[model samples]
Target chain A: MRKVSSASKNADRVFRVATGVAASSPVVFLVVIALIVLVQAIPSMKFNGWHFIYGIQWNMGNLYGALEHKNGVTAAAGASYAALPFIVGTLASSIIAILIAIPISMFTALILAYRVRGVLQWILSILVELLAGIPSVVIGLWGIITLAPWVRDNLAVWLSHLGPVVPYLRGPVGTGLGLLSSGLVLAIMIVPIITATTRDLLMQVPILYREGGIGLGMTTWEVVRYICMPFIRDGFVGALALGWGRAMGETMAVLMVSGSAMNLLPHNLYSPISTMAAVIADQLDSALTDASQMAVHALAELALILMVLTLLTNFLARWLVTRTGRRRSTKAGVAA
Target chain B: MGKSISVTDLKAWYGDSLTLKGITMELDANRATAIIGPSGCGKSTFIRCLNRLHETSPGAKMEGSIRLEDEDLYTMDPVDVRRVVGMVFQKANPFPTMSIYDNIAIGLRLGGIRNRTELTDRVEKSLKMAALWDEVADRIHTPATALSGGQQQRLCIARALAVEPEVLLMDEPASALDPVSTLRVEELVEQLKESYTIVIVTHNMQQAARVADKTAFFLNGELIEFGETTGIFTNPVDKRTEDYITGRFG
Candidate 1:
């Protein structure tokens, strides 16, 4: 009979523990962050109930002259964060960013992933990665110094025409810190995330798919649009979700160029406003009243909401991936 | 030995390394021509070269002449050459993402048939010819991956046939399939030979013996013998061919 070894048992136990830790770490980290944000946000939500979310009047703290006390009511009483302006700012900037980024990023990613090769591919790939590596603050500063003035001076005539088409474009016409500025900055910030991931997805496609597509006599662009893109639509969506989340969470850059003005909504394309992040930066440190504190807490709640939205988007993309994965290499059924 | 596809001092290379050296043989059209050899003997490579699918790997180079009738396929466009000669792989590589119907339709669509009615007709005819129409007709709309191994091989055959190429190439088409599926594919090949010039590469001696009209024995990048299948199996003209068929060596 072979002797049982205690050493092997101990090694096996250690291996099991290590594997568990490796598997659970990411899941635990995500759950903990979500719980923390949600727990911190619960009190703010409890205070004003639905009224806090629906009410548009942001003048809670000083505007109402609410006094501080042992009571949490003063925090709820003072003029504080309203979802309306922050919601408008976020939607406006993100949409503008997507509009600008999607066309250019798609073209760039398509060129890099498919058409370009050799040294040019290497150089362009590096440049795109470098763009992603640049910090949000750097993008904001660039937008403020370079892009803002350039667009203001050169695009002034085009900017005026926007008002006639849309009610939101109604505003005093000067291109300083505004919706367009934050959006353009957001476009620059998100382009790399979208481009790099799109490139990776494109690369992961089997060479056979391209051959098969070409063998069928598809033109270069048609093959990409139909065969290549369709096969990796889920990945592109996943990249877009990441880009959108990054744009939503942006702080220093949007604040720098967003003008951080307390406004009801964008009356014009050049209308300056505060994003959720910008509001947090401006008000969190010196939240003088209880309502102001609640306002800060509300931004944290918004962060949780954004987290949930992106998580849901990721789930949708993952589902699509699995659906396609099932069919990649199956053979024909044997006839009975 | 089979249908005539004139080859003259043919050589193929991958980048700097030559894989097939000064090969010369005529492939008989309208008959199954089997090339049997060891794993790296370039039997599969030789068949793929026929279809021009060999150069799909970047830097794969072929020299000398591979004339399909009077026209040299190397001189003409490879895409046009590929369109003329269809290939089936070692593995039954059906596009799992596509439906059985769509899998058949894909090659036709690539061949530039825009009419849905024409695509549907061609898909049906090819499926029927491949002997897979009955089993798969009901589930034609279902994903190809949902099929059994034999069915997938037949589906691949149908996909190849859908384009209506002049010649068909198989690279161990039944190697991954079960015996029954292999037999079905072999039988399907016999039927396909009526219209298309058939070139097959098989490791299985019995499979080659059962189906091939001509057999070409290869070893270590060289063609040892090319003759009638009946003569090669029964009374091999070369000792190497005899040794290979008698189970003394691969």
Candidate 2:
């Protein structure tokens, strides 16, 4: 605890300053990029007013119809921004991804952490660790090349085999690059991330709780169900949200598989889709008309909405973690 | 009523490394038996084996025969043994997720008790048995985790008693507690002996003399000596027991 000499103190200050800047550089860069994106997105949106967020119809030729756009609500700007499709795509894909990924990841995590404990566990864990290293383009390319065609042929074959029992299986016939295919690719991509995170959380469960439950005559599975699962529920939720956020905003893989078709009320699994990021990527370049520009700008707004939702999920998980923090110090607040 | 427990040729192995070497002792009905030994000498392991709790450790193994009134404990079934014999840990381990009332009711529900009135009566009775009813009666709905260290320990005792087990195994139940709570637990152990056969493992030798009717001394996983509390503490036949008791060696 004693103070160092002035020379040592100066060296320490220099070292601290260097380390602080190095550590914060990545965060600073990310913030700057986000700010830039926000700045670019705002001006065009402000010009469109409330109609920018609404109005389903979109066309380029109706830009300056003077009678129609008396207050500058021109038909050329004819219902430029309808965020409904992108919003639906983002939410549907995210929900589908979460529903498919969470259970698979949780079970994978549990198996890795508890059932398998030696070099096998380590190898599998390393494989999951390696998943994060796979660039998004590789996954997008793989989905485009391998998954799409397989889905089409397999679903047709599967639907034919179960013709009477299931009809929807037949309906999503040859259009492999669609909502369902995109969801499948997203699920596969998200699982490794969720698994790795949930495995870490599962590992965080104290040995004492597992011992306590088993000592009470609970079976191994029962111990996991009642004690281990409940103890780390918040953390598992955090992991799911992490995966969900990543999947929801994923641009390249979704674009490769989503078939790039935008329409209303996407009920069909075989139906082509376009997520917010994909629309921004695909349409932003060809935004020659004012309406097309506004439409692309609206996709950026959707990105902001997805960010807020992800942030909200993360905050709630963190809150639950704080609320359920079990410890010795917590006891002093009450007598019994 | 509490039942007599007979342990014969009890040996525990932690993955081929012998821990408890040939421990044979008879615990009398409605009496407390304190097992004393140095840390890692298998006193705790031996106690946990009575309720099949030793299997909690990943590599722990057992080769022994323990019986509660002719019913073989080691072979009967872990669930049945757990039902018949309950254990309290060295550190208090009240389920943090449960309320005080629910903590007591855990055993009752585990045993398949469904009636609300029966659950209430059993919870009340168990809490009273552990001397925790008066302190926790009103806030029984409060999280059991909200209690003090001593209260959590007592709640665990109450939890064990809730199922009306014939024998109780306590593995240094007061080690993590304050002196006042230690005294309370000791007093509760004495009171509990009226209807429950008790086996306690304690690091404190004076505690053995105070509450234990019979005392067993273990060393390096071997049963060194066991007899009346007075004889084991004052007139031990084995030099090892004498050394352990008189602070000659751990």
Candidate 3:
């Protein structure tokens, strides 16, 4: 081995440090953001305790001694600020979106990756990419103007017939700006992401596997069903997790179409709901204007919960990927 | 139930480029026919066309006719045609997602063999035929990819065999293996020839000489010569064939 010169050794040290800093930057940023949210949420935590998360009510004037009567002065009525409604709404809509999005996106990805060819394939791929690029606000606007009324007139009426049998469908179907519409809009929004990722993963399956299946007299569909899907099962799960995270964080679109009601629990798919992000987006200005700083603190607490939710989702997805990856490697090792 | 294959004026193309041009040959039942050629000389392409695997490529097309026994292969469904004519690729690909047992059983399951005992028996039989059963019998539940490269190739052969195809096409199946593994595959091919018609494409002239009953030499996408293995190697029918066999030029 040759001895390194002092200048070259220093340069190598500097390069290593630089790369280390670059790699750790995102983690540092996340930590800083989490600390800020936690600091801001301290006041709310002191006032409401854990009820801020599990309590279902969302009145505005209930912050720390804000309504205490003193010196012959009548105090304003206190407001309740339970966050359960928003959490429920966020989870329900996201679940609905995933259920609707996965099958359509999977099939679209399959067709794009394997069946279609030539100029048509290129055009279809471009369209999917274009869908991903379109602004969420624009999609929200369209959902409000067009999709909402169409669902109200059509799906709501059909759903109403099942009202007596199913309690969830028993509520009056308002002009379709509610849980179902928001979920549908979310489905449309995330389809492109899921499809593009699934398509790329499917394409990554080696041509040899396809040849092996074809040689064995399996049809293209069977090949995809058995070989391609299983080979990339972990990837597909990761894609769905990504889509779920996106749906959970979605604000503007859900706010516009979900009717932004403070419903504790949705009675039907057509029932209006409010998500945490939507609540913060809808009331941050007013919360800041109020004399009591409790509302702002509550909003901060909500933001903290959302951040934690996002982190938990990512951790779960990572765990799943690593578990599957480990199993595959060990199996491969045994064979080798 | 090996079947004779007669290829008539078989021409293959990928887009506008010709890969195999008007190559005609007769492959007899229960015999091994080796196709030898230089790289890009369409040795692999020729065998791929026999099972319609060549046409699976984008813009790939084939003209002329291939008859498996009395049936015109082109007129038949490609899926059905592939069922009767199985292929093992140059590289071992034993469905990484499947276990050793499932890898062999998949072909049978696809062919609508639903009985569990029947599938297990066929998988064992095929594995035994490929001479891979004794090594893998204990870990048949393990992923097929866990096997060594040569074992994986044998597993792929067993997978194809499980389907009970009349003909098996192998493309340089031992080229990727060690010398000992190569010899094992060669011996296995010799035994397999007693039951199935085999067409193997190989770049190794020695491999062709060792296992092939009839040898076909291809050059520049055309058949240079094809004859009995001993005659093709011992005597020169064409200068190009002799040059290639003698290692004069690929």
Model 1 agreement with the true structure over B1-250: per-residue lDDT tens digits = 1235777877788788778887899987798899999888888778767767677665788877888878888887767777777788776656646788988887677667899888899999999999999998888988777888788878888988888888888889898888888889999988888888898999999999999999999888789999999999999989988998998987
Among all windows of ten consecutive residues in candidate 2 chain B, which has the lowest summed lDDT? B102-111
Give, for candidate 2 chain A, the lowest lDDT window spanning 10 residues: A327-336
Q: Name the regions of candidate 2 deviating beyond 4 angstroms.
A: A1-31, A46-79, A153-174, A288-296, A312-336
- Can you tell me which runs of candidate 3 are displaced by over 4 Å? A1-23, A62-77, A159-171, A317-326, A330-336
Candidate 2 whole-model C-alpha lDDT, 0 to 1: 0.78
User: A200-233, model 2: which lDDT tens digit per residue?
Assistant: 8888777765666666666677777877787677
Candidate 3 residue lDDT tens string, B49-156: 989999999999999999998999999999999999999999888888889999998899988999999999999999999999999999999878878988998999
Reference-based TM-score, model 2? 0.86
lDDT of each: 0.78, 0.78, 0.88
Each candidate's DockQ: 0.23, 0.32, 0.48
Listed per model in order, the count of residue pairs whose N, CA or C atoms clash below 3 Å is 22, 3, 6
Question: What tens-digit string does per-residue lDDT give for candidate 3 at A1-336?
Answer: 998999999999999999999999999998998899999887777767788888987777643444643233322247556788888898889989999999999999999999899899999999999999889899999999999998899888887889889877765888799999999999998899999999999999989988999999999899999889988888898899889999999999899999998736787889889888999999898787656666787889998888788778778877877776525532332122
What's model 2's lDDT at A281?
Answer: 82
Looking only at chain A, give the TM-score of model 2 against the true structure. 0.78
- Which clashing pairs does model 3 show? A59-A80, A61-A79, A62-A79, A335-B146, A335-B147, A336-B146
* CAPRI verdict (incorrect, acceptable, medium, high) for model 3: acceptable
Q: Cα RMSD (Å) between model 1 and the true structure?
A: 4.9
